[model samples]
Structure formats: C-alpha cells, structure tokens
Target: MITLTLQTIGGLMIAYAALRVHHRVYTEKSIDKKVVNEMRAEQIVGIAGALLLILGYLAAF
Candidate 1:
C-alpha cells in the first residue's frame, strides 16, 4: 500500500507539472473551459498526493 501510494504520488507530480506548464498560464483568450478545469483538477491531485506522501513518510518513523 505504501509503495502504491508513493508511485501514485510520483505520477501525479509529473502530470501536474505538465499541466501547470501547458494550461495554467495562457497568452490566448480562446482557451477551452475543459482545459482550465483539468488543470485545476490536476493541481489538486498533485497537492493531495504530495501531502499523503509526506504524512505517510512521517508515520513510518
């Protein structure tokens, strides 16, 4: 379970970084709402994953 959690966190972090670069800051006004929503969702997932990882690591002491 811990290994799975760590792997999920790593994947989420990579995906989040990609979304942040490609969708978060746009110079065009014609961006799709779906893209915006996905970006936000990805960010949340990434943050949650990171927090879970930290908490799990702390718990393993």
Candidate 2:
C-alpha cells in the first residue's frame, strides 16, 4: 500500500513537472534571466524527471 502511494505521487509529480516545462517553453518568449540557456533547462528538467521515475520504480520493489 505504501509503495503504491509513493508511486502514484511520483508519477503525478513527474507529469506536473513536464506540463509546467511545456507551458514555459511554449508560452514564454524568452528564457528567464536566471537560466543560462534553453538547452540547460531542458537537460535539467529531463534528468529530474528521469530520476523521479527511477526512484518510483525502485520503490515498487
């Protein structure tokens, strides 16, 4: 039961993060001042999402 809950939370977090990234990339005319570059943002978000997924998978065991 705990594993299922964790997995669901992790999945939701990943989906929400992805949606936020998509919205930012599409709606914003330019990258934020803090961000070094567009590619960097993509890489960071991608890695974070992948890590979340891996953690969720591991939690199932």
Candidate 3:
C-alpha cells in the first residue's frame, strides 16, 4: 500500500515537471536567468521523483 502511494505521487511529480517545461518554458520567447533557474529546480524534482519510483518498484518485491 505504501509502495503504491509512493509510485503514484512520484509519477505525478514526474509528469508535472515535464508538462511544466512544455507549457511554461517552451512558450517563452527567450531564455533568461530566472527561467534557467526554474528549469534547474524542476529537473531536481523530476530526478527525485524518478528515484522514488525506483524505490517503490524495488519495495514491491
């Protein structure tokens, strides 16, 4: 049960990170310092989410 919850949350976070970049960053006309920073933060979130997903998968066994 805990593993399922973790996997779900992790998947959502990963999807949100990807969608945020596609919708917010992609629409920008130019790349600025702030946007770059936001992208970096999002990347971290995505990586964390990926880790959670892996952890959950391992826990299932």
Model 3 Cα displacement at 44 (Å)? 0.5
Residues 1-61, candidate 3: write the lDDT tens digits: 7768776776877677686775577456478777767777776777677777767676777
Assess every candidate by TM-score.
0.54, 0.45, 0.54
Model 3, 17: alpha-carbon shift in Å?
9.4
What tens digits encode model 2's per-residue C-alpha lDDT throughout 1-61?
A: 6777777677867766776776666557476645536545675677677677767767777
Q: Ten residues in a row with the worst lDDT in model 2?
A: 31-40
Best candidate (score: lDDT)? 3
Query: lDDT value for candidate 1?
Result: 0.66
Candidate 1 structure quality by residue, lDDT tens digits, 1-61: 6786677568767766765675545434367878767666776776777677667666766
The per-prediction CA RMSD against the true structure, in angstroms, equals 4.5, 4.4, 4.0
Error in Å for residue 58 of model 1: 0.2
Q: Which stretches of candidate 3 lie over 4 Å from their true place?
A: 1-30
